[model samples]
Target: MSSIEIHQFMCRKDNFGVLVHDREHGTTLSIDAPEEAPILSALQEKGWGLDYILTTHHHGDHVEANEALKARFGAEIIGPGREQDRIPGLDRPVVGDEHLILGEVLVETIDTPGHTIGEISYHMPLAQAVFTADALFSLGCGRLFEGTPQMLWDSLKRLRELPDETMLYCGHEYTATNARCALTIDPDNLLLRERATEVEHLRAAGKPTLPVRLGQEKKTNPFLRADDPDIAKAMGMEGADPVEVFAAMRKRRDSF
Candidate 1:
């Protein structure tokens, strides 16, 4: 059986640029185009040509290098159909709850609108990985830039349904800050405390705190635990609707 390889690197200060490759089919694609320089560098270092660009949203920071990379590598650009007009050089607009195949790998498109109205996440069950972009993060989630709190909470619920073993690849490197905020919300959570300590050490060591397992996030990420009774109790909102608790948490996080 052939294996898949992922190249994750930092771009544009805190954004992440990821390249997913299928060794069996000699197919390689990028998750997002944060910057041309870093994307080009990572591709060159891997000695692989880019075949496709899977865009998660229309944010400038994420799609700025779309045209450049496409022109350079003649790669196909796929993005959210709802925001096709916003994404530059979008060759294929994909909607949520759709599936496509790249080589022998199956790619599942999940609707995750919150930070952006048309944001989507890419999940590859075969690879046991999902690229969540700004919709979901290690210990937090994206701010409500273009969507509502309800929209974001709904989107997160969909993500939480993903298998426990799935690895989450988000668009930014804000885990350390998120950890601090998470502790404020769930101070008595031993797992969260330990994870926060781990995040601190990782950031201190100049290491990336990404590709966190979904199982870990389910237990530690406050945003994902909005429906948990314990989470609601911690927020002094016992029996409150999950969405209400989630909104309160998001509001607190905004200022945290």
Candidate 2:
């Protein structure tokens, strides 16, 4: 069993600030530095000192508090090697497909560009979780800001290859909106409908609807199901390439 404990909280409007703690090793790390105050509060509450910051991208909202947290906790920042120059106080630059051991836990970085040209996702197999910062969301994927639809689609495909039981921890709390858009594309999906209702209730209760299972996302998230014939048909593009279907869905979501 995994001994790692994960604490997730909202930061800077919709961005999520996450802390991954290994109790046995007394190692505590954060996913991204969305803000400094809340992160510090969380660390204090948990009585854990920050040891590392695992950055998924170089976006301002994601890395805005990098230097502040580093200065306060002396945490080492590890980020995408491809965008190392963009991230502040980056001590370790890692590329996709590279494996590193931190606090006795193996961390695998998966290149998930499309949200940004150099975005990456951190996957911890033993912990059964993947932090897909901006590359993928619950029922939607990030906007293609610096990459092509093909690039985003390919990145999502790689993420889909993870174990079905793996939990997905995304960068933002956009499930409610994404769920609404997902139903429009896959209206006939019974699972999607159920998930949409669930999302609505979660938001109404002001609860986080994240850490969703990859298996559930694969069945309900339209972006991940772009290749499904039913989804393609729903979009009026039957037998279309998965990338084309994915592109159409992303474009529609952009305006949604």
Candidate 3:
């Protein structure tokens, strides 16, 4: 088995687009098409051809370039099974827990519905990585646009169960703001304070803060820390259900 190669780049305003390649078989996959120009540029820069498009949801910003890319590369599109009608150029619709083999890698989808109905995150066990799209971020998760906080919480818990070293490739560059908000709620966290400083330095250098390790997020991301005693105490929800703590954190982030 060979390793999976990943290329992460900026697209649109704040969106981050990703490309995954299985070197052994030359199988190239794109997580979402936030835009056409950048994705095309990435492909050109890497001299890699796109073979598949795996979408997380039906948001316009995420799928707007699906048709154009498919037309250009003859790529097969796979996405949320329930939203095939909305996902332009969808060739295969997949629900949660389905597996797709890409060369030496196994791509699995987990249902993540808090950000949007039928949203999913792709986990490649061989690569120890998950393309979370808008469902989960470095130090934050997406808003509750189509589902409740509890739904998002459950979805996040699933991701949290992945190995600590799992790399998280999120959809946007929102870590700076997420870090600030995380500090407000988790002020006593030394790890979070250190991470906030590191995030500031990364953004100051105009670098990407993504592909964050799941273990680091467990320590610094307030949303992921709902079960931690320190976070629960800070939120004044000590002993409360993690779902309730998660809901309160989401509300705070929304207003922050």
Candidate 4:
């Protein structure tokens, strides 16, 4: 480990962004910006200069502030290759499986195209963190907006193969609401039940319930545990493949 620093900032109440600052490498990478005001205020209040803006997808809330921040800080804008037209001022359009270098940190971009046509998640080996934008949330996942449900399910499966310690960081503060939805499907799930309790406490105390570990997610998040028998059974399918089970769970969550 190179002592990477992760700062989670709650911008605009619901919208969230992350700043990964590596002091040893002297580089700071800013995740998607739902709005420019929060990004600018964060940079000023925390005395951080935005070096790069990594957008997960082309949604307005995700990339709406892309152009403004890039012009102000001259930061490199990295967007998924599938959305050149949707994302603004894309300095680098990366495809899936491309390795992105951020100073001493190497971030592997995982193309997660279910939420949007060009959605991608950033993975860092050293930090054991994944910025999963809208593709996957704490207890739920993003809706199938562009790609098929199968595409999103496959993307999440690939991410699940990572080390159990990998930390998940999403684009929004939807943990509390997501946990509530997960309970409907897997109420007896020990991990989910415990997490709901914990999340409630965090929310009441006005704290962030993100950067959850991969091991923890596997135990609770139905979207990530499609292979689990309980999840498949809840989906009303016997021996249903992970993709089918995941799709049903996503559909339920969408309506939840």
Candidate 2 residue spans exceeding 4 A from truth: none
Instruction: Please list the C-alpha lDDT of all candidates, in the order they appear.
Output: 0.94, 0.93, 0.90, 0.85
Q: Quote model 3's TM-score.
A: 0.97
Candidate 3 vs candidate 4: the TM-score winner is 3
lDDT of 4 by residue, 1-256 (tens): 5678888887766888788888776677888878888778777776778888888888888887888988888889998888988888888989889987866778899988888877889999989899998988999889887788888988888888889999999988899889998998898888789999999999999999998998899889888888888778876887988787887888888776
Compare candidates 1 and 3 on lDDT and give the better one: 1
Candidate 2 matches the true fold with a TM-score of: 0.99
Tell me the tens digit of each residue's lDDT in model 3 across 113-221: 8999889899998888999998899888999999998889989988999999899999999999998889889987898899899999999999999888899998888
**Whole-model lDDT, model 4:** 0.85
Candidate 2, clashing residue pairs? none
Q: What is the lDDT of candidate 2?
A: 0.93
RMSD of each: 0.9, 0.7, 1.2, 1.4
Q: Which pairs, if any, clash in model 3?
A: none
Tens digits of per-residue lDDT for model 1, 33-68: 999999999988989999999999999999999999
Residue 131 of model 4, lDDT score: 92
Please report the candidate that would top TM-score against the real structure: 2
Superposed model 4: Cα runs more than 4 Å off: none
Give the per-residue lDDT of model 2 (tens digit) for 1-256. Answer: 7899999998999999999999899999899999998998999999999999999999999999999999988999999998999999999999899998998878999999998999989999999999999999999999999999999999999999999999999999999999889988988889999999999999999999998999999999999988899999999999999999999999999887
